[model samples]
Every structure is written in C-alpha cells, then in structure tokens.
Target: MLLVLVFSLLATCSTAEEKAPADSTPLRLTDVSTAEAFINSAEVVVVGFFKADEGNGFKEFLAAIEEVKTLPAALCSVKEVWTNYSINSDTITIFRKADLHQENLQLSKIKKLDSDGLVRFLTINDIRYITEYNQASAVGLFQSKVKVHLLLFANRGSTDYKPLKERLGALAPRYSGKMLFVLINGKEKANERALGYFNLKSSDLPRVGIYDGESDKTWLMAPGEISIERVQNFCDSFVTGELQKEKQAGESEAKNEL
Candidate 1:
C-alpha cells in the first residue's frame, strides 16, 4: 500500500470548515467553480475525485467520513475539476485552508483500501481547534494561516491535566481565526526540544505561553494559577496590543540599561 504525503502551499489562507451532519454523505461536486468553493469553504475537507459510479475506495471513504463528522467531505465525479488540483487520476484529496495544504491519496497506487485505514488517515490529519503537539501534528500547526499560537504546556498524567486541557479547549474557539491553540505534553520525551525552546522543563509546568510565528517571538505567561479567566485575559491582551506594547517597553528598558 502507498503512504500518505501532505504537501503545503507557498502560503496559508482560510475560509472555515463546519461540522457535517450525522448522515455524513459527501457533497456532490459538479464543476470547477463549485469545487473551488468547497475547498475554500472550510479549514479542512476530504474530497474523492473519480470518473463515475463513485469509483474505488468511495465506499471506504464514506465509512471514514461517518466517523469523522468534524471534517467536511465531498465527491467530485467531474474530471474537469481534477486538473485544477493537478489530479490526473482517481484520487482522494484532503484540503486544508490553514496552510493551503493539499494531500492526495491515489487509488491506483493503493493495493488495498479499508475503512479502518482510511479512518486512521483522516483522524490523524484532522487538526482540530485545540490540537496536541506531536511530530505528526506539527505538520498542520506550521501550515496554519493563523500565525500566532496560544500554547498550553502540561504533563499528561498530572491531576490538573485533563481539566486544564478541556478548559482551554472550550476557551479556544473564542480566539478562532485570530489564534491557534496548541497543547504541549511535558511528559513526552520527544517534546524535550520544544520545552527547551521555551526554556521550560517538565518541572516548570503547567504553564501557558504565546508564540508569534510571524516574528518568531515567544512569551511565557506569568507563572501562577492557570485559570480560564487568566488564559482568556492573556489571549485578549495579545489581541488588544498590550502584549506588543510590553515587548516594546522591554526593548526600551534594555536600551536604557545600555
């Protein structure tokens, strides 16, 4: 069987993706303009392009979509739209507006197609509002159109972990389109480098930080209680320009020290 390769565009843009209905049937795409509309209409979408009769893997794709109602899905039988996406043959493509990512799974290359495999593929790449940071998901995070990230750092098994994650996750959507929320598990050995980037250790958690991707700047929220109100205020401060003002003040102080 062939593996999955997700390709990022030169830049990222967004419309927004709404959760599909419980029925989970893919929207029928008929033309180039409509295809363009569907792709741009969401943060992520999966569209299977086939010649007719919803060719190979369509049944499996259907099963996968039912399990992943969070991602919008569609079917394109029209060959004309395929060329626009550089799709020459039967393919299942996952489109993401966050990073302008286009991932293609060629049916011709896959020796076997199973609903379970398709489900894994879709769920693994299904970057949500508050996503856990990992090697696999880092691909989606870096591709986000939203340059600023509000990150939650916590240990996996700690008493405060689950509630903190859920708290921030609930508060996350409030900053949607403005910022991306990321969870960094301090317990993961693989994430040590990420911890080091923030000059943090597992002992120093659970902390909150803001990373501005555009300028490659990072700021740690003051060490104290990690309350939802505090997190909300921290996010609002960045949005209200207080954070940038503070950065400028710190720069001025450094100059004065000089």
Candidate 2:
C-alpha cells in the first residue's frame, strides 16, 4: 500500500508541475531549521511536501492560493524531509501563528483540483482566517489591532443563520486585511459574558455588532432584520462616524446582572 501510494503521489506531482503557472512562486525549504523558522515567522502559511523530482501539486496549490489577497500569508514547498517528519505522500498543511500542529487543516492524498474548487474550500473552511466568536473569544477580539465586526447568531448548527453567514462570508474577503470578521453564537453558554457585555439577549438573536478595538467601544445594529445591504451600510456608517451613538435600552439584560 505504501509503495503504491508513493508512486501515485509522484505521478500527480509530476503532472501538476508541468502545467504550473509562472507567476506562482512557492518558497523552497532546505531543512528542518528553515521550515521551523519560516512557519514560525509567518502569521499564516500553506506548507506542502512533495518528492524531490515531483512538484505539480505545489504549483496548482500556489495558483489557487494566490487568488486570496490577505497578507502575512505565504506558500512553502518542502522536499527530502518526509521520513524525518513521518509525513507520507504530498500533504498540504496550514500553519497559523506559531503553532506547528494545526491538524484540522492538514490535507493529504489530494485528488486533482481546479482553481475554483481549491479556492472555494479555503474560503468556506475559513483557511483565510476569519475568527470564530464565543465567550472565550471576546478578549482576543477586544485586543485585536484591527476593528471587529461580529455576526451574532442563535447557533452554528441552526439553518436560521445561513442567510447572514452567506452575506458575511462575501464581505470577509473584501475586508480581509482591514478588519476582522467574527462569528458568535449568541445562545451558547460560553457566550454569556459576551452577550452581557454587549447588552444583548436571546430575543435580539441574529444581529451584528461592531467593536472598535482602538476605542474599546461597541455598537449594535438597530435594524430588526439582517441583509447584505443593511450590514454593509452599517459597516459604512461606523467607518464614516455617521452612525448615531444613542441606543434605546432594551430588556435583553437580566436585572440582577445589570
């Protein structure tokens, strides 16, 4: 099985390299030291391993990766160290911040891919780095250098969140480098503190809020319903300082907590 796998991988990489695009430049890692150094330094990077003589997979991967415009991200192709790391076949791994074992993102035995399929996978899985929000995530978002626009929902598993999620996903790429888009579960116990901090309740479920990290102030949307245009206008108004500061107090708060 191992021998057959190796041969099949080598064939895929060879075919991918032949048609590789010229503009895609994947950094080559020489050894363990270089790999560690590069991965640690990059805020986010896509790392892949290929046989010394086979590299088509890396090319296709790079072409798809290049379409994303977020910064602090790069592509790396490494060879000759698979045995040292127990990595079999060509595998694509995502390293974020300083962690070397963000295992949920490691992909191996990859089938052939077109640019669209690969890009769509990355976007949907948030490999481009849109942060997930919850109670524990509030502090991190508050400390972020970039302003945060949090999409609050009843729960991730509910179909009710589909429309809002789809809308925000479209804007995530556009605001990628400029701001952070976070998804928060309003009904979860983990988010109790966050909900209190924002003065939100279950009745006000499925909403949007903007946190200005620089000023440590947050504002909630007034519109009863969510739509792409309304959310975009809210973001625009916040950015332009045109949104009103006063908000009508609601009963979303528990009296004892207030």
Candidate 3:
C-alpha cells in the first residue's frame, strides 16, 4: 500500500507571551489560516472537530487537552477544515511536526467523546513526537512493549544532530504507537550506566541501537554513515526480524551484504 504523507507548514515565529503554558481553554478558531498558525507553533496539536451546537463531550476533551503538559495542545471546530485531512464527527487529529522537512505524522481517531476518552486515546496510543531518553527514562523505555530505536550520541554541541534527528522524526510516525525512537546523550554522567550496559563508548560519536523490550535483547548497528535511508533500513529490517537472524549468523550490520 502507498503511504499517504501529510505535510503542514509550521509558524517560524511567535510572541514570547504566546508561549505560555497550554491554556485551560483551547485556542478557538473559526478559519483555516489561524488554525494552521496555531498547530504549527505547537509540538503536538490535538484538534477537536465538533459543531458549535454539538454535545459537551468535545468541550470536555479540549479541557483535558489543556492539562496535557507532555505536549503542546490546541483544538478547533470541524468548520475549520485546514486540518481536516479525515474529518468526521468528534474527530480528534494529532498533527505532529517532526522537523524542518515539514513532514507531519498525523494520528487521528473518529469516536472519542469526552475528556476521559481523550486521555485514554493519548495513553493507549502512546503518541510522543520526540522520544528522548536519559538515565531517568531509560528503564521505562526498556519496559515498554514497543521496540526502542535509540540513537546513542556524545553530545549535540559539535555534530549536526538536527538532520539525523529530523530523519528519526520522519520515521517515527510510520511506526507511531509501535516503536520508541529515542536519543541518549552519552556525555551525561548519569547516562554512563546505560551506555556501558549497551557496550557503547562516547568516542563512537553517533551510533544506532535497537532494544527489544519484551525479550530484553539488543542489537547494535556497526558505525557508518548516519543517513535517513540507513536508519530506515535498520528499523525496517529489525521490525521484520531479519536483522536478528543476520546477527546470530555472525554477519556485520554494515549492510546486508548477502
């Protein structure tokens, strides 16, 4: 099946005061221009599409969105169709801007009715735009049912990690709720344990690793050019169970030379 890629332009600038914590009330919009601006400025914008005379469920859902501190939150009515990629009653769409490439990972649901339902949707979906892990979040990542596709790096100071990060962002939505793409900074003293456990070194610079949380197994990619295709191949092969068989047969991860 051909994948449909939805791209959205994000606002590059906004007033400082506009950066306040998510409001108790959503940024109500009656048109597309303002809705685009609102979604582009936030990390993850949850748009609640409902008629003005509709039930109170959507209103409650928007209220729950206001309290979700993990991601930037917003909402709009169905009348505003700028973000209506798949519009329907009580349609809640999450527009996530992964990078400067403007490639968005849109996850939408059609039937959620209230604040509790919205919270359940977010929890069940485990939709995170940037899944960065440190010593603090490492255990949780390991315990998750989803596979963790992690990038081990020394620091973000010298190297241009933005491009690689953008690539990961693009791939993340493809896996959506199934995979956890994370970045672990090796320079941090607290993260040394995680680095050592994975047999990684700070001198390795940038490398990719995959952890199977269920089986508690890990596979490392032999250091090479960090490109979107390379990482995508790694993830694709890993998901298909091909990489593990190759690893057991004593083959290199440089590329499946067979």
**Prediction 3 global C-alpha lDDT:** 0.54
**lDDT, residue 195, model 3:** 54
* Stretches of model 3 off by over 4 angstroms after superposition: 1-25, 28-70, 74-127, 134-144, 152-154, 251-258
- RMSD of candidate 2 to the truth, in angstroms, is 15.0
Model 1, residue 114: what's the lDDT? 89
Q: lDDT tens string, model 1, 1-258?
A: 001111211111221224435447789998999999988786678998877765788788888888878778998888778888999888888886433468788988988788888876775566656777754466656665677889898988899988898899788868767888878888777666666656788999999998887777766787899998999999999999898789666955533432
Please list the C-alpha lDDT of all candidates, in the order they appear: 0.75, 0.52, 0.54
TM-score of every model versus the real structure: 0.63, 0.47, 0.53
Give me the candidate number with maximum lDDT. Answer: 1
Q: How well is each residue in 1-258 modelled by candidate 3, as lDDT tens digits?
A: 001100000111111111355555566766777777877775456666655534556566656676554445555654546444445554555655432122222223334356666665543333344445532234334434454545535355546555666677677767655567776655555555555545666766677777665555667776788777787788788878898888767744333431
Candidates 1 and 2 compared by lDDT, better number: 1
Instruction: Report the Cα lDDT for candidate 2.
Output: 0.52
